[model samples]
Target: MSQSFTTKRYRRYTEEALKDALSAVGNGMGLREAAPVFRLPRSTVLRHVEDTTQ
Candidate 1:
């Protein structure tokens, strides 16, 4: 029997884009809103936001 394994793919984003996303969130933008606008994943943005607040 042969088994196939799947690899998870992650979106590629520039450091500038991430900074912009986080900046938008800091400036009163919602995570959902910032994610799409900055072409970043919502979870990624959320994690950074949470980290900075701590």
Candidate 2:
């Protein structure tokens, strides 16, 4: 018998793109809606927003 395993990895979102995504959010968009648009998780988008602004 043999055993196999699988792992999931996250694709990196660039800082520049993150900034752009944050800008979109700041302009009055929901995180959930913005996630797919920026190809990022809502949490990631929010994180970038907090990081750069502070």
Candidate 3:
């Protein structure tokens, strides 16, 4: 027998919102603080910030 699995696919936030969150961090807002304020995931914000600085 064979089995198949499905995963949920969706983006709850927009790219503009993500940029705003990153900007907030750039302006001194903590990652933890910026995530919820912009409705973005903390890990996502951290990842982008890390990418840009590298």
Candidate 4:
């Protein structure tokens, strides 16, 4: 027997794009504040901010 797995495809952002999101912070916004502006999850933004490899 074989097992199958499936996952819903979600939007993906590039490094530059993520960088742009962080730009908001540099411009005087909070990390969580920038997340909404970029339409990205706060956790994801923070994770990427803390870990560049994301």
User: Which candidate gets the maximum TM-score versus the true structure?
Assistant: 1
Of 1 and 3, which scores higher on TM-score?
Answer: 1
Ranking by lDDT: 1, 3, 2, 4
Query: Tens digit of lDDT per residue, candidate 3, span 1-54?
Result: 887988988658999999999988999999999999999888899999999999
Cα lDDT computed for each candidate against the true fold: 0.96, 0.82, 0.92, 0.76
Candidate 3 pairs with clashing backbones = none
Q: Which parts of model 4 have CA positions greater than 4 angstroms off?
A: 1-11, 14-16, 52-54
Of 1 and 4, the candidate ranking higher by TM-score:
1
Worst 10 residues of 1 by lDDT: 2-11
TM values, all candidates: 0.86, 0.67, 0.79, 0.56
- lDDT (Cα) of model 3: 0.92
Q: What's the best-to-worst order under TM-score?
A: 1, 3, 2, 4
| Candidate 1 lDDT, 1-54, residue by residue in tens | 988999999899999999999999999999999999999999999999999999
The pairs that clash in candidate 2 are: none
Give a tens-digit lDDT track for model 4, residues 1-54: 987988988777676667888777667789878887777778878887677545
Count of backbone clashes, every candidate in sequence:
0, 0, 0, 0
Tell me the TM-score of model 3.
0.79
